[model samples]
Structures are given as structure tokens and as C-alpha cells.
Target chain A: MARLVTLVESGGPGVREVASALAPYAGHAQVIGLTGSPGVGKSTTTTALVAAYRREGKKVGVLAIDPSSPFSGGAILGDRIRMQEHATDPGVYIRSMSSRGHLGGLSATTPQAVRVLDGVGCDVILVETVGVGQAEVDIASLADTTLVLLAPGMGDGIQAVKAGILEIADVFVINKADRDGADHTLRDIRSMMALVTREPNEWRQPIVKTVAHKTEGLEELLEAIGKHHSWLAEHGELQRRRTARASAEITAIALGLLRARLDVTDELASAVAAGEMDPYAAADRLLG
Target chain B: MARLVTLVESGGPGVREVASALAPYAGHAQVIGLTGSPGVGKSTTTTALVAAYRREGKKVGVLAIDPSSPFSGGAILGDRIRMQEHATDPGVYIRSMSSRGHLGGLSATTPQAVRVLDGVGCDVILVETVGVGQAEVDIASLADTTLVLLAPGMGDGIQAVKAGILEIADVFVINKADRDGADHTLRDIRSMMALVTREPNEWRQPIVKTVAHKTEGLEELLEAIGKHHSWLAEHGELQRRRTARASAEITAIALGLLRARLDVTDELASAVAAGEMDPYAAADRLLG
Candidate 1:
């Protein structure tokens, strides 16, 4: 599994072949994505969740996507330290993925990683990432169910972070529930949700509170996720989501193939470089 | 000029016409990009630099890229407050571009913005961006010379921000140098530069300290930029960089065209979405 994931990480014809071989056995695992701002106990919550799933006698896979920013530490070891309790558990698989710098927004091969874990014996895969903004949105697009985590005493920080993340979250988990101002944060989220207009039959994103370090409220969190899963199946939303996800996969793959076909020869590039021809004109010639 | 930039921002056939119309007169302007972490006096320094250049009766264009991250305030008004000195000058054109979220790193149309500025008779175009991650690196690739700003007493924050930025920076401007530990920051940059092996004739990245608010050391900064520009010309690096930049532009254009050629019928997407066929196979059908 690790070897296949490494191939997916490197990403080329080999990974494509691996993906093709695995496609027959894939699409069985539940893909759950967790995202939140730094200092919100995301890693702790991910570790606790892994234990919860493993207790059910099911295999679990954790893909911790370390932020690609230079400001972030090389934190693969740090994540291992936190997940040490699951170190010896054969039922749990944890991997930290980091992007090559300047590759643009989150790694392109993340969906492939999830596909790899699904094709293995894992029944549940948790895709956890750090930071808000575009990264969180991308996570939501890739996951079967997306959980957006927050904590108390963040004050206006919560207000700031909630802007674009409100729609993409499937479950809202206010971690560190024992901390001060937990009630205030809950009230703020309630008010914000009130502002969002939703259809009467739409799935209302439930808010759950937990102190993830102590594994408090693990049962309640599991109940919320299970209810969401059932709701997805009943409303035919599961198939819709899978179809949308597959469409995105197909589109991304098509774009890659198109990029490979771009015929920017040295002579054309040199002409644009020399200002003797503009890029649009040069591209025109190359395309012809 | 504003209309053309708008067309470029929309990114389609209109921009193609606009670019082709302007390409004949482009390639004369010097594109200088400034990037740094927030609060490093980037805007103030840019304001000061604009005034200094305007003193020589040169037309200048400032393109301030408001970061796409949710954490940043919508600061187009803030940037304008600092550059109000140039507000009345017809020769100075300043535009603040805020990107649509999840649109990816920086903006794909940034080069087209530069092309518009150059064709409109701007002698020097300043592309300014905030943040210390992939955004900074993208700015460096788009500009002839990239300036990285640092403030005194940023402490470990300075250490963290300098990782990927050091190699791309053609000039290091230590803004807020009036504060304490200015010399300390200067030394850190010098030692860091020392670690990078360079040929004897290679242009050394010069460190210039400035209290941007007070407009101290403006002449030295300009001189350093002038020297770097001269060195780039003498070494034939300018042509090489432009060719690489044009190659990227041409490839981006070609990709856009190839994407239009993809024949993803609803049946193919439906097959992948329904799980009857995998995405890679669907992509192959679309490409066929």
C-alpha cells in the first residue's frame, strides 16, 4: 500500500497504471476529510478519531497533509509523535504527505491517495489537512463527508475563518469544548448558520462539541457522522456526490493529457522571447 | 487601458485580441516585483519608490495583488491611502487586483496585466504581492527583478520567511530599519547569502536597509536595482528569463486551447460518475 501511495505521490504513467489496476477494488471505503485553522487541535482530533474507528475492528487509514508553506515545520515526525498510541496497531495506517514547493495549491494527487487507501483493506480513511481558505474547499470537494473543526476563545478569529468555509462543511465540530467561551462560540456559529438560507429538506449541518485530546464525545461524533452517511444514502446524494467527484477526476486527467500535447517548440518560444512575435500569435502557430 | 486589463482578467478571446493589439509596443518596460510577509513595510516602500521614480519624470504602473487568502482584509482601499501622493499624477497608474478565491496561486492572467501596463507606455511596472509562500515565488517568476522585504526584529519569523524566498530575490530590502536589531537582520541575510555557492562573476544579491516610512536609502535601493539590471543584460540572463516566461505563457495559452478540444460527452461523464467506468478510462475516451 505504501509503495502504491509513493507511486501516486510521484505521479506519472506508473501511478496511472497502479490506479488502473486498483480501480476494480476501489470505492468501498468512506472518505472523511478534516480541516481547520492551526491551534484548533486538528492533529489530536485526527488521532483520537483513528482510535475510535479502530475499536470497531475495522482498518483505518490516516492521510495527514502537512501544509506546503515554508513557514510550516517539517512536521511528519511531529505527527508520528502524536499518533504514537496507534504506532503498533496493525489496523491503523498513518502517512504524512508534503508537497514539493511551488506546485501550487494542495497536491494534485490527493484524490489518488484516497483511491489507493480505499482499494486496500481499509474500511474508513480520514484525510486531514491544516489551514483554511482554498485548502479547506478542496478538501470538501474530495471527501465523502467534510468536517470543519473550530475551538473556543478564538474571538474574531472564528468570524474571520468562517467566511468561505460555511457551505463546504458537512459536520461542524467545535473541539476543545471544555475551554472558556465554548458557549459563545456555539452561539456565534448558530447565528452564522441562521444567516445562510437553506431549503427545508436540505441536510442541516449539525454542530458537535468535543475535547478531542481526552477523546470526549467520541460516541456523539460517530453518531453524527453515521446519521449523515444514512441521510446521504436515503436522499440519493451519495451517488450524486460520487458522480461529481468522478467528473472532477476525469476533468483533471483530461487537462493533464492536454498539457502534455502542448507543442511549444524552442523556435516558437524564442520568437515570443525576442518580441518578434507575441505569445498568443506564437501559440497560434504552435497549435496549427 | 483599464478595459484591456479587465478583458485580461476575464481571460478569453477578448484578451487574446487585446494582447495581440498591444504586443507590437510591449517588451520595453522593466517589470519589478516586490513580495514579503505582511507588515514588512512593502506598501510604504513601494509608495516611496514610486515617488523617487516619478522625480525622474518616468511613467510607472503599480499592480498590487491583494492576497486571495481569507485571513487578509480587503485592503485595496488601504493600499490607495498610502499611494495617494501619486493619486493625481497622470503618469502614475495604480491598480489593486483582488483574486477570486480557489482560483489557484496568484492569478493566471498576471502576465497579461504586465503586458497591458508595458504597452500603455509605462517605463517601469511594479508588481507587488503579500505573503511568504507560493505567492512570493510566483511573483519572482513573473518579474525581471524580484525584491524581498524584511523588517528588523521579526526574529524567528524572519528566519522562517527566508527559506524559499532567498534564492529568488534579486534585491533584499530590510524595511523598518529605523527599529532596533536592523544590523542583526542585515547580518542574518549576509550569512544566509554566503551559504549559497555562486560563480565569481555571478551577480551577488545586495542587501539594502531602509526605513521606508521616512524614505531613507531610496537612492541606494535604486542604484542596487540599476546594477542588477545592468548585470542581467551583460550576462544574457534577461533574454533567458524572458524566454522561460514566454514559454510558460505560450504553454498556458496552448493548454487553454487543448482544453476546449476535449470531447467529454455527457455519456462518458455519466459512465464514470455511475462507476461503470473509471475516470482514467473516461479521460482516454474524451481525449480520443
Candidate 2:
């Protein structure tokens, strides 16, 4: 943790030393992914979880990925601001990142940020993405556990299923539970869940309802998270998931570096801009 | 047009061949980019414009990009359905693309699709994006003129300006012009535009009001597009913008290819499930 502090705080010499020193603890912490549509009280639910974990005497790191403000070049900053009540807590560390113009759900800096938090010895790392559409569910691969949040009255379950978020969910939480039609939403989610065949390692997704703003029913949420953790640990999937996540981190870093080196030309950009070249074709020609 | 049709339909030739054939009419057709927040009637405005153009004896191609449903590998397909009313018209060509899990705001096949439409000899291409968040804006760079659309009563101008969409507006349209606060939205947009100075060749971004469903103020909208187009040509900046855009497309394409080549392992899939790595980093690593 000490090694990573300097490494994270200082970018030059400290990074390598910290990377070498904190290499062992990389797989110890629990990484959880939380996602749903925007305005579903993600920030609120995350805050509740952080508080609950802290109450249990665990050090927690909350990483919130906010949509970037193109003009500001920073996070929309709403999620961070909403969680400011924890700003003074020593056991709670919070960081917010913008998508950084990357098209996928997670921010470009997110995996690195997660590694930094893990290296700092946080017992749990809560990674929250800006509510992305179905395609952004890629965040599921990064965590030991994945939670897909949904709300009542958010159109139909068919729309929800078609959204693709339902496919990646290991656990579903119907947040804003106090709203009318919560039961209908819950029933819809269960029916949708029934449509998919689960693997032996995967459990029936537990749907917990919560008015995230009030933090009600968070204990059940934590208990469910604990159950998921136990399931993974006993089956030995936790370590596998972690190692795979580390490998992904390396993969993203490596790809980012390679992309910087390709040095695409003006003619190619013109062709793409003019709609003459698709990204795949451009990629195929540049790399092939 | 024949070359593009062959490139898209046959896929035997590369993008360079299609680009080469389409180079002749680069200056004749003005490409427009339309974007806004989701549910803001971007489709309605785009449909209105396409209809207007076709009525004026201009052949139009509408390239609409929406995210695919990850579960079904199909799109909600709203854009295509919305514009299908004109499907039978020989002067109108409309194609819908799902983001198809790519984060760069375009599906891998978008460029090829555009070429196919262009090759069909459409006088103008109207590209409508899912929304003007980061990925959508990245996709919008594919167009010659980009329009940022906002609806009234969305929020204060502060909320609207801080969004990623406002930065790329070549022109701003307050769609749903019949709404109560449309004038206020226009005033706010003008006030916000006053605070920022654009590049020498860039237009001063006129704010137009349009009731897309009613077809109100579309003439003015067309006039605004025409004015921006003329402004770029008069200053000889049209070619410069087109060149820069093509260069960016090439750069983005090269990076995407490199990412794909390098990270074909199960590592990305696993971490992506965990929510730890974004698709772009994977793409970036491939670029390296």
C-alpha cells in the first residue's frame, strides 16, 4: 500500500517501483461492477455500499466513471460531488474519471485507476460506470462480481431485455424501489432471467430492491455481495477472474500504446470523414 | 457510385479503391452531421430534412447509427423504423447501423455503408447519430457539417452547455420548436455561444428553431446548412476540414486494427465481463 501510494501520487520513478512492490496484493481485493441506466440512483446506491462496507470496518475505494463534458475536459463531476460527504473519511477513498472520449463504457484511465486502488490495499473496489447502453457491458469482465441496476417504470421488460444489460448481470438490483410498479419490474426481471440458462458457477440472479437515496435494504445488498464472493472463492473462480482482469489491464495498456504509434494519415481521415472508409476497413488496411 | 456499390456489396476490394472512385464529387455534396441527447427527436429532425431535400430534387442518403442490443445482436432499430416511411422512394436511401459493440461511435461497417450510399450517387448524406455523448461525437466527425440539437426544458443552458454535445456544433437546432420554452432555449444557446469563439473558418453557429413533426422552420434550417456550406467554401476551408477529418479517420482506424490484432486472447473477454477494461484500451494495445 505504501509503495503504491508513492507510485500513484508520483508519475515518474515511483510508478515502476510501486508496480514491483504492490504486485502481490493485486489479486486480493474484491472488485465489483455496478451499472444501469442513468438517473437510476447509481451514485446513491454506491454511496450506501461504501458506507456499509466502512461500517463493517473495511477500507473501501469507490471509483465512479462519469460521462465527460467535452468542453470541460473533466468528469461531469456530478457523481463525485454527490459523494462529497465521505471526502473527510480516512478509510474511504473516492476517485472519479471521465470516459476520456473512449467509446466503451469504462473510462480510458479506469483499469489503471482500479489497479492503483487495489495496490493501495482497499478491501473492496466499487467500479461504477456512467450509465451506458447495452454495448458498454464490457465492464463486467473487469470485476469479480457484476451488478446490473434497473428501476421500475423504465419502459417494458422487453425494452430492458433488448437493452442487453440483462444478459451480463450476475445480480440485478431494482433501485428506486419505492416507486410504483416495483413488483412488476421485479417480476419482469425474474421472467427475463429465467429465459437464460445459467452455468454451474453462476447463481440465479438475486434481485434486491432499494430506495437508494435512503440506503434502505443495503444490508441485504451487502449480504448478496457476500454470497457472490463466497460462491466465487469456494469454486476458485475468484482468483481466475482476478488474474484474467490483470491480464485485461495489461491488454488495454498495450493496445493504447499501439494505437498511439499507428499514426494514421490525413488521407485516411478524409476517407473516413467522407464516409468512404469504415473503421474496420481502415483498421484492416493499416494493420494488415 | 458503381465502385462503392461493388465495395460494399462484394467486399472483394479494399477501402482505397472506393475512396479513389468517390474522390471526383467530393466538393459537390455537403455532408451534415445531426446529433443531440437521446429522445430529443434527432430522428424527427433528420427525417424532416431528408424529406425536404428529396422534395427539392436532391437525392439523399441517411446513415443512422444506433447501438445494438447486446443480447439479441439486433438493434432496438428505432432509427430505421422511424425513417422507413420513405423506404420506397428511389431518391432516398436509408440504412441503419447498430454500434455493434464498437466504442468509437461507429459500427465497424459504417464507413463501408456510407460509401455504398455515396456510390449510389446521393446528392447529400445526412448522418444521424444516437446522441452527442463522446462516442456519438466521435462518429459525427465523419460528417462535413455537424449540428448539435437540443430540446427546450431539458435543463438550464448551463446543464446543456456542459454536456459533451455542445462543443462540436457547427450549428445548433432547438428541435420541438412548438414546445413552450423553445425561445428560451434559443436565447440560452445564443448566450452560451457568445461566450466561446471558434476558429477563423468555423461558422458562428446560428441557433434555429424547428418543430420537426410539423415541418416548421425547416426552410430556415436548410438555409442555415447552406450558409455554413457556403462559408466553408468561400474561405477555402472546406477542403482543409475534409482533409483533417480524413486524417483523423485513418488514425482512429489504424488504432482500432492494432488493438484487434494484439488482444484476441480470452483476457479481454474475461476482464470485459468484470467491467475492468474498456474496448478502446484493447484497441489501443492492438495499435501498439
Candidate 3:
């Protein structure tokens, strides 16, 4: 399993070989994305969710992508320490991916890693990311069920709304529910949802309140996730979402390869800089 | 000026024509990028800087890119209101670009808009953005001088360090300098900067403190920007930076056009799903 993940991360020729071998076994596991701002207890909620899934006698895998602290990898280390409860559980697998400053690299590599886990007999895969930036939002395209976690008194309601997190959330988990203003946060999300005019047949995103540190509300959150999964399957949205994911994954890879192929000549760049050629014309020439 | 900006933002076929026509008149403006977290008074600082530049009898253009509030365009509205001092000035042009949920689209469109501003007899161009994500970081490539603003008590020091904002900031502004912990924030940034190992000949990044709301320290901030501009020109870094920007812009455009051309078929995606083909192989087939 470690070797397969390494293959995917390396993004080398081996990725193709490993992916082809695992392709047949993929799509069996339910992929869930869990994301929220920092200090929102995403790690605690993820650990709770993993334990709950394991209670059902199912294998689980986690792919934690941390864009923060690329130099120290501190956040991922803290997460591993906190998740040690599952360290001895053979049914659980965990991996952490840190950003290496390559543009679009994380989004390109994550789906392949998830595919590997799916192929390796994990009954469930949870992709946990800090929902702070564009790369994190890209996870929405990959997961069958996306859970946007929010916490009370964090000013998260406004931040989440501003960041457009409301659009991607299938289940909104207001963690730290026991904290003051949790109900206010819940109301904020509900009011925001009320603003959207959805078709009657459309799935209404459910808000699940959780004090994740105490493991309270785990079952309800899980139930919401399960319900969303079922709704997706019933509406054939599962296939549509997966198809879109595959399309994006393929396009990202193709573009990465094309980038590797086309080296912008210094002369061309100098021409553009010298104001003798426009960037659009330069792009056209380079593409040719 | 507004029509040219519209043409660039539209990304229509006429963009190339407009770009080529304006190419000869470009490369004259000194583009400065100012970015920081929300509530850091970026608008206030931007307004002050525009006023300062105008006092020097120079034409200025401001492009405020807002990733948040794309739907309502509220940030731009706020900026216009704050910058109403220059509303009647024919020498100053202000435009706002909102994120339309397209990946790398802002980075793709911004340089064209900057080119338009540069073409239209603007001596100074200010590109203001919320320093939150990858698109904001990409602004470093487009600007001659990048100023990262941080306010006291904002926890921006740690956020800046985590986001690797240190590398991109050509100048750091400790805005709201009269607030408590202003010195602490300045010390934090200074300490962080002290850890960096720079060559003797390299231009060190300067930190400027400003009470932008009071219009204090505006001249010093402007002086820092001028110093950076002069340093860039003397070191030939200006040409080098523009060359790098053109390269990235060209690559992004080429990749975008390629994405439009490659259609991922359902059969191809299903083949990958069924383990009949790897994604790399699938991409190859699609490219072929």
C-alpha cells in the first residue's frame, strides 16, 4: 500500500502501471471529503468518523492533504499523533500529503492516491483537507460526498460563505457544538441555504452539529453522510460526479505533460518583454 | 480604458488583436501588488498610495481582484467607496476583477489587464488582492514590486509564515500602526526576515509601517516602492521578472486551449474505471 502511494506521488511512469492494475478494483469504496478552516477540529472529526466506520466492521483509509507548513510538516505530524488510536488497527490506513510548491500538483496526485486506496480493499476513503484555498476546493470534484465542517465562534460562517464553501458542502458539520454560538452558526448556514432556490427534487444539505472531541454526534454525522451517499446513488449523480472527476483528472495530467513538453524560449519571452510581440501571439507561436 | 479591460476579461478572440495593438505601448508602468488578509485595511492603504502617486503627477491604475464575494462584488464596491477621493480624477483608473470559479483564470486574465493599463499611459499600476490563496500568490509573478500588508493583532504573522508569503513579499507593510501589538507584529516579521540568508548583493525586503486610515507613513511606503523599483531596474530584475511572467502566461493559455480541445469520452473514463486503462494511458489516447 505504501509503495502504491509512493508511485502515485512520484507521478512517474509507474503511476500509469499501478493505476492500470488497480483500475478494475476501483469505485467500490465510498470516497468522502472532509474540509474546514484551521482550528475547526477537522482532525478530531476525521478521527471520530474513521472510528465510527470501523465500528461497522469496515476497512477505512485517510488521505490528509496539508497545504500549510510545507517546510515543517507540523500539521500532518500533529494529525498523526492525534489519530494514534487507529495506529494498531489493521483495518485502517492513513497517509499525509504535504504541498511541495508545485502548482496543481496536489490536485493531480490526490485522486490517484485515492484510487490506490479504493483498489486496496478500503471500504471507505476519507479525504481530509484544510478548506483554505483553490486546491482544497478542488477536492469537491473528487469526492462522492463532501462534508464542509465549521465550528462555532470562529467567524467561520461568514468566511465559509465568502469562500463559496456553501456550494460544495453536501453535509455541513458544525463541530464544537457545545461551544457558545453553535446555534447561531447553525442558523447562519440555514439562512444562507434558504437563500438558494433549489428544485424540490434536489438534495437539501443537512447540518450536523458535533462536539467531535468527545465523539458526540458522530453517529448523526455518519448518518447524514450515508443519506447523502444514498441520494447520490439514487439520482445517478454518483456516476455523473465520478465521470466529471475522471475528466478533470485526465485533463490535469494531460496539461502537466504538455507543460513539460513546451519550454518557452527565452527569446520569445524577451520579445514579449521588449514589447515587440504580444503574449497571446507568443502563446500561439509556442503552442505551434 | 473600461472597454479595453472588458475585452481582456472576456478572453474573446479579439483579445489577441487588442494585445498586439497595445504591445508597443506597454512595459512603461511599474506594477505594484498589495495583498493581505481581510480587515487589514488594504483598501485604505491602496487609496493612500493612489493619492500619493497622483500627487507626483503620475497616472495610476488600480486592479482590485476579489476572490471572495464573487457573486455580489461587494469588496470592489467597498473599495470604490473608500477610494471615492479619486473618483473624479481623470488620471486614475480603478477596475475590479472577481473570481468566476475558473482555475488559474485570474492569473491568466490579470496580465492582460495589466498590459491594458500599462498601454493606456498609466505610469503606476497597483494590483490589490486578498492574500489568501494560490491565485493571490501568483500575483508575485506579474508585479514589479509585491507588498504584503499585515495589521497588529491579526495573527497575520503566523499566517504569512505558513503561507510562504515571506518569499513573495518584496515589501512588507505593518498597517494600522497605531494599534496595540503593532510593534510586536513588526518584531515578528523582522525576526522571521532575520533568519533568511541573502547574498550581499541581493536587495533585502523592507518593512514599512503605516497608519493608512490617518494617511500617515504614506510617503515612506511610496519611497519603499520607489526603492524596490529602482533596485529591480538596476539589477535587470525587471526584465527577468517580466520574462518569467510572460512564460507563465503563455503556458497557462496553451494549457487552457488544450483543455478545451481534449474531450474525455465516457468510454475512455469507463475504461479507466474498469481497469482496462490507466489514467496516463487514457490521457495519451485522448491526446492522440
Among these predictions, the greatest DockQ belongs to 3
Residues B132-157, candidate 2: write the lDDT tens digits: 34556565566778888888887552
lDDT of 1 at A88: 88
True contacts kept of 3: 0.48
lDDT for each residue of candidate 2 in A37-135, tens digit (9 for 90 to 100): 766778889998988888889989887765435334334666767888888899988876555544355524466567777766789899887455532
Structure candidate 3, residue pairs in collision: A24-B275
Candidates sorted on TM-score, descending: 3, 2, 1
lDDT string for model 1 (B55-164, tens) is 98889999887643343433336677778889999989988765333334553667778889998899999989875345666677788999989888763531243455
lDDT of 1 by residue, A1-288 (tens): 888887876665586677777777767888898988666888899998898888888899988876434333333456667788898898888887753333244435677777789888799999888654445656777788888888897635312434556777788899999999888888988898889899988999999999998899778889889999889889988877776677666766777666667767778877776667887788788778
**Model 3, range A1-288, lDDT digits (tens) per residue?**
978997787787667778777888878999999888767998899899899999999999998887654433333366777789998899999887764433442566788888899999999999988775554567788899999988888864223455467778999999999999999989989888888999999999999999998999888998999999999999999988887787777777777777789889999988988899998888899888
> Which candidate do you rate higher for TM-score, 1 or 3?
3
Model 3 over residues B1-288: C-alpha lDDT tens digits?
998998887787788899999999988999999888777889899999898889899999999887654343333366776788898999999987765434442565788889999998999999998775554567788899999998998864323455467888899999999999899988988888888899998988888999998989888998899899999989999999999887777776776677678898998887776566778888998888
Off by over 4 Å in 1: A37-41, A66-88, A100-103, A130-134, A149-163, A173-195, A207-224, B38-41, B66-89, B98-103, B132-134, B150-163, B174-195, B214-220, B263-267, B273-276
**Candidate 3: segments with Cα more than 4 A from true spot:** A68-78, A81-90, A99-106, A154-163, B69-88, B100-105, B156-163
Q: TM-score of model 2 relative to the true fold? A: 0.85
Model 3: docking quality category: acceptable
TM-scores of the candidates are 0.84, 0.85, 0.91
